[model samples]
Target: MGELRLMKGNEALAEAAIRAGVDAYFGYPITPQSEVIEYLMAEKPEERTGMVVLQAESELAAINMVYGAAGAGKKVMTSSSSPGVSLKQEGLSYIAGAELPCVYANVVRGGPGLGTIQPSQADYFQSVKGGGHGDYKQIVLAPASVQEMADFVKLGFELAFQYRIAVLILSDGVIGQMMEKVELFEQMPRMSDDEIAEKYPWAVTGKKKGAERTIITSLDLDSRKMEEHNHHLQRKYAEIIDKEVRYELIQCDDAEYIIVAYGSSARIAQKTIQLAREKGIKVGLLRLITLFPFPNVQIQELCKRGIKGWLAVEMSAGQMVEDVMLAVNGNGKVAHYGRYGGIVHTPEEVLQALEEKIIGE
Candidate 1:
């Protein structure tokens, strides 16, 4: 309820997950994100809340464990960094296809290969546009600070269960390792077993003596049934897009330029915005909290409001800028700025881009 103590981003995320009544955690130890599993291990919630925590064989096994537990209608979660997360994509696709509820924390590190153990928001498309195959969308929560790491875990789980979907807490290594103050609630309210079963009756638990055996699976022998299932998932995604668009508008009242960013990149953009204001530049930031929904409507509205240029500042090479362009609808100039392979851009760098792209122009 009140500010409690300083905690690392990964540690806070684990604590918040425990408080959120997560039933099971299955994950392998990966750099940066390993602290999340270590926190759970050290805290040992089983003594208090009867939670299940398993250090799995690999990220592959961990994601499958999430699939199994989520199929049972229990709140479940797992965590990994970039390469580790990439390993779990097949399982993630299965979870998405099955339309199960789970939380996956991706403490993003360098990419394209086993690049480095530093922060990078390079997985923007992977998190938002479906890391795995098939037409699907995950509820991606982009957390900017250590406190956000704690907060988004609970919100992610709630949204996942509510929408019958997977949710991703997309953070980065710097955000993961940093120590910051966070107020963790005493406990989070949880739905009862009866309530869960009542709400998600399709979950596979063995049937009674006379009842039919409930099957929970993404597989359909018939192509038409599979098509129907895909249609249902698409409808759910459409509803999420309509209802779950979330982003922050900073000083856009009469802004001449809009800086679009999210996750840790958004924090850097905030500093850039402050500097821009001090320099008498009428720039604003639209920090997206929900990456999947993409907040296209906000960007579109800003473009309509005479924002001459939009800067897509990210930690990677222009992944989200594609969406920004789509949202701008060719009405204004959209430019991309970033440093990839685990290099996070500084506020000065972002401001420089803004200056060169907007002011100089």
Candidate 2:
């Protein structure tokens, strides 16, 4: 109802950032996600909303820039594919170490090392787990459609500011490239400096007259202080786990089996559920929307409902399934199935895998 338009997922992300009142965007262009920046450049958010969009020379530079802006209480963001995101990990870690608020996106592509430009969920471990070195967690949103790709930008910023931590929108090439209808939100005014000062009293605004200078850094040379900081981060992560578990259930009331997936794989699983239901298979679909906070509680609740088994269908060799297995914890069997290295699994193939791996076997 806001403004409906057909848009590629990446373009939708750009428009959403503009309307989200983001202060800055600093990122490098990479395949499958380059449209994010291309759309921003063409639309010129500067003239529209005073948003500063800069294409950094490298992913490393871009992420560090994000760190700087976010430390000063500005809403900043960046986007990249797998490899490009890898290059930004150190900066991301630093941002996390300092407990900064910023948004990032990884339009994931196949990769162990530049494997392919095609979409893959192989980055699951990196996004949900700590990709950077440390004991920190990021709030990760997995968007299943172009509309979500747009909507999550606003949500991501909200979460980032709410918790004063990094947030990630984990998309893959499938959604990044696919065209779909999206209803975009109305524009939001950029936050003023006075508002930032009122909101983020800890931010490095500058040395005030006869006031203590604010220092922001992740570094605490003292081992005791470092341990305390880590404990603080852990507590924050636990709070997020308690409050931010988000997922969608499809035909799960009397389900004997459930297929677990996120993003594009979840989209395909919707169809697979229909096919299985037609064959009298009481299968349901659990589409996970937040990967980091993880829907472990939901899965456990399903186990309580007598779900016999689960099939984790993703675009990876097997990652999220491990988490599912942990959540199930011998309550039921958990198996993984997917087409890897950029090949998408068809609804029929997923149905077959579900039948063979958990049902038929």
Candidate 3:
């Protein structure tokens, strides 16, 4: 346990990265998330913990820097908003193909283009469904609070290294900009060359005496070899799905109606549940913490328990609802309610939709 302090989500995330022993951070400035790098620069982790921080010329350059550092077996990270994250997709695909471990955060804004600087979960599909090319998956974690914003950085790094895969902390403007009390972790020292060698033996660090040189690249000219690599990735993803499904079920016992949400929407849905309960409506909430794993089994089990209906509340039109429907598998009716273009839905609006669309019908 560490000291508790009131902080913004972006600041918490940056402090947590320092405490998580990140070796380097390479990122470009982006709205609702610029505070992450700004804090890192002001803290001067280079002096405090020997951590390196650099502002890249562009998101493309930042992600490629991450790829390089991660390939060298260092704990590196980057952060950006939606459009910037989109630019990093190519680098992300390369990192996944090379099987490098790193953490990235997308403090998302509303988007199809350079949407708005306000909160949005429209990037859910992109984050979970392989935003870049190739058949690959990145572990996605959604934080509903400033505390989880800090906590998930540690968890993200742990998972990234454990599976040798990229991990995404998919937050939005609401969570990133909101202020809250957060308890941060203790400071951790950066890893040394010996530590990296012991931990990531296959890393493309310089070869030891009599040891074979290691190469890190995603390029495979042979089709059969590429297919084999894809199969291996699939196996790794399946294992991650089986082992790392994380979510929170609030007031679910004996409830007839359920609300499915993640990130900021989960916080809003919590209030909706309270309001609905006051009216004697039995409603519960399923808050997804690990979005990539999807928590399908938990959702399916809940659906099997004979819930009347599900309403997926999001900041986007209807991205995550598709996953909810897939999990429900026709067991019950599922509906989606959202506000787009940088707009956030109010708790009252969510409750109203729940009543009209799910409870009333």
Candidate 2: tens digits of C-alpha lDDT, residues 239-327: 99999889999999999999999999999999999999999999999999999898888888899999999999999999999999999
Model 2's alpha-carbon lDDT is: 0.94
Which runs in model 1 stand beyond 4 Å of their true positions? 189-195
lDDT (0 to 1) per candidate: 0.89, 0.94, 0.95
TM-score of decoy 1: 0.97
Estimate candidate 1's alpha-carbon lDDT, on a 0 to 1 scale. Answer: 0.89
Model 2: residues with Cα > 4 Å off, grouped in runs: none
TM-score-wise, the better of 1 and 2 is: 2
**C-alpha RMSD values across all candidates:** 1.3, 0.7, 0.8
* Cα lDDT, model 2, residue 257: 97
Instruction: Give per-residue lDDT, candidate 1, residue 54.
Output: 97
List pairs with backbone clashes in candidate 2: none
lDDT of 3: 0.95
Instruction: Give one digit per residue, the lDDT tens place, for model 3 in 1-361.
Output: 6889999999999999999999999999999899999999999999888899999999999999999999999999999999999999999999999999999999999988988999999999999999999899999999999999999999999999999999999999999999999998999778898889888887988988898888999999999999999999999999999999999999999789999999999999999999999999999999999999998999889988999899999999999999999999999999999998899999999999999999888
